[model samples]
Target: MPSFINNIVTLALASLVLVSNVAGDKLIFRNRSDQVRWIDFTPNTDGTNGIGDVRVEPRQDVEFSMDGYGPEWDRGRGWRGNFRAHRDGAPREYDHIVWGEVCFHCDSQHPEFNTFDVSVVRDPNTQEGIHWMYPRGDPGAGLSGCDHFPCSTCYVNSGDNWQTKTTTSNDIYVEIRNS
Candidate 1:
């Protein structure tokens, strides 16, 4: 009888611990940039679904709570990533926008979003960046992909260019802004 009582107490204690964790944990993001940007998420915690593209307006933020992780020892590996801006423009610029991406790599899983350590960047050779810039405001770290795609072939468009730039953080929430 005593052994059965101890087991019940153990289970009750475990339930309380799990409930406390869920009640107290949450992820937060702050977007301080002036332009709209996109963010993507890949959680090792949940291997089933990919958190798709997220659009964050300037000075806005978003967040997610930590869902229960997979049963693997490596679940919830750290997350960090690159940024990009896309919009209508010359053929090369448009093509650059369409192709601008930073891909995450994985094993036994589809590749995830590549995390970053250094400042936000635009590498033409790697074909990744937030390369879209206004005629007046240019961050300058972008692909000259425009040089390759003829401006004449792609109709020029004066539409809003959207981008997603990531700042550094721990294994939890990630900042989604250039600043």
Candidate 2:
């Protein structure tokens, strides 16, 4: 390539590194629910999220640093794929005892947290039920919403015929259901 082109490429590459180092990994947690929800991201190693808690106003998309819970944590490690969310609406009625307890708590694990916006999508439904307690990024099986390993635990992670991960990261989204 030409010298000018080479220099431009070099600049772009350098900028990406700078941003990754300075900004670190982040996730766009969009709240599509009708009520506001308070989010508490617990780092796998037990660090509090920014401000010790995050509140995503109704119908708002917020950016969070999964870069560990506190200063002592792994700053580069993005969201823990876990949350303690509280909404203002009445909790939905369900049949199973586990769903009642699980959704009521709004806590779980999955590696889907590490995905980039390009390949992940959070729909109105279908996400992992925060299955299997562990660092989601690690190699292992996960428990889905139905007590199955690696399945749709929440509506967000569920992909339908209408969409795919490459098209939108909407399924990778989260919501604050009424408590």
Q: Candidate 1, residues 1-179: lDDT per residue as tens digits?
A: 99999999999997774444323222334455566656544343433344456566677766544333222353333222232333212232333332222212222243222222211222223222232211112233222223222232111332212232222221223333331
lDDT for each residue of candidate 2 in 2-78, tens digit (9 for 90 to 100): 99999999999977753353243444455556667655443434453543656778778777654434234443333
Per-structure clash totals for the candidates:
6, 31
**lDDT, candidate 2, at 57:** 83
- Residue 137 alpha-carbon offset, candidate 1, angstroms: 36
Q: What TM-score does prediction 2 earn?
A: 0.39
TM-score of each predicted structure versus truth:
0.39, 0.39
TM-score of 1: 0.39
Q: Model 2: runs farther than 4 Å from truth?
A: 1-22, 46-51, 67-81, 89-179
Runs in model 1 lying further than 4 Å from the true structure? 15-25, 43-46, 68-173
